[model samples]
Target: MPHLNLTRALTAGVLTLVASQALAHGDVAPQAVDTTGLPAIEGDWLTENPYRAEKVGEETWQRAIEIGASGYNQNCARCHGLEVVSGGLAPDLRFLEAEEYGDEWYVERFREGYTQNGITKMPAFGELLGQEAAWAIRTYIEARPDEGALDDFAEELKAMRDQMEGYIADASGADTEALKTRLTEISAQIETASGAPVADSVAYRAANLIDGSAEAFKSASEVLTIGLSAAH
Candidate 1:
């Protein structure tokens, strides 16, 4: 619950501090994140992530995470790594807390960016993406499962994915409800490094996609396949 506490040092260090010179941040142009389904946010920027499930309801929060995943992968993944995990080139943002303190550091860096030795390591994203995208990305960042949070359930999840794959081939005997229930249980057990109440892990995502339909099973199976592959 502490420096998984990036409050103080982060404000003065973290992304603002030194990094590898070989870092490749790619295009200077920020990618456009489509936040069509999310609620529009305007005016002054918020200090806290307004899209958290508590503030905006679970439905909106989930939507924000979905939209935010796209934004982060496109704009922040090169240095920050996918799912907010860092590769030593940039700060690992997953542990940044979900409170006002962490939010302040994040908003500042995200808006002002950082530079060292005349190189633009982090580009100012506030203008290009706007508030909705910012908060959506924030939501996704805080919802990331902690490193190895799924390790305990890996084998079970793999077996479940295989079962779901079978259901995809033929859904006549699919125990879709059971699959969704088990996935939801696994998701609940996974913890977010940011200390957010819930994590938007693969199990949570796939569980939501499951609805006792062939298309739903296929979609869930694909999510599991990709997420598991990425985990390793």
Candidate 2:
């Protein structure tokens, strides 16, 4: 698989998506999202996402995040903002609650879209993208870490990223397991703005990239570089 090239932990000023904006997303053309590897949704649109960890276990849940990130970047990023961080142009979707109510609200907009006074600000995505892509995108939107989620650890993380670079050059003394464990622990501590179980932050991505190889360290280091750089 090609690299996901996660654009994460952005120091966004606002939300994952907006609720009601006259010029929000209604005008943009909906893009087709590739939902391959994701479990399909059946029997009409779902009121809740089936990709949550508890519903389909961690493996599928993680896949949903991956696929959703791609789908979101392709389809929703224009109005929703890159990395789900609204730049005051649209409502931040990160705060959208992650329960039945939020799910219903998101599905409604995603399916039917929003418009006002004869102008189409958001287009209906139900027919084109299907319920699977809808929920996959939702999975990603809700998993965004709260704004400033990485501020506390930014410098420390930068140091680790630099250390990982050294490991790439000389893999002799690298304690790869310890690095993964530390990153995992940091990932667990981060909180999502939407109250989802996981934040899918840079730490989480970095930890998953480690495999005791130079290439793995290089990839993980790049993930940190992009994520940390965006935080500021």
Candidate 3:
């Protein structure tokens, strides 16, 4: 009976070790990112991010962020950390610059992945994940605020929030174009102040006008809330 008990203990220990390793490297398998909601990129993958809010429109950019967040959580958070905050196992993706300088390296690394000796560090995700999902992840990463990136924009974000709220409160027969314009301006200011891509929450909401109705104002108001909270 003592011998039998020892055998069971050894088995249990092995099983536990295997389980932990699996959990740690579960992202090794390719996870599917749903890019059906996003606009399809034609031809081969572009070397740069085409989903920037200014380039692809805010709604599309927002959709990309949504998909990218899920993709990153599934495939990247294991090493990259949640919300792009790294715990030192990998580089903090949030600090990646939003301009071409960052884009060049990101595209290359994503396409080829990183391998040290015979060990694969980062798996190549371009072909399996597709450009839409990759770009979406990039968009999400670029939008993450660096340390102190939004400090100077706190008061401005608050002011923008107030303006959006006022619009929502008195939205009856409000000029949709004017509201969109104001929100767009605010988004630009956010990008300029942070020196990073505008957060999808702000970019998407600011650009979309839902038929000039109260619903539109409500949506814009919600965007403001999310953007302000993120900035703060």
Q: What is the per-residue lDDT of model 2 for residues 1-232, given as tens digits with 9 covering 90 to 100?
A: 1111111221231222333343566667788888888887779778988889999988898988998998899878887789988766565778777787778878998889765566666789999999888998999999999889999988889998999999998788899999999999999988998889898899999999998899999999999999998878
Candidate 3 C-alpha lDDT tens digits along 5-85: 224433543344344323333237769888888888889768778988899887787788888889889888887677676
The superposed Cα distance between candidate 1 and the true structure at residue 4, in angstroms, equals 4.7
RMSD of each: 2.3, 7.0, 12.5
Ranking by TM-score: 1, 2, 3
lDDT of 2 at 7: 17
| Steric collisions counted per model | 1, 13, 0
Work out how many backbone clashes candidate 3 has.
0
| TM-score of every prediction relative to native | 0.91, 0.89, 0.61
Ranking by lDDT: 1, 2, 3
lDDT of 3 at 63: 81
Better by TM-score, candidate 3 or 2: 2
- TM-score between candidate 1 and the true structure: 0.91
lDDT of 3: 0.66
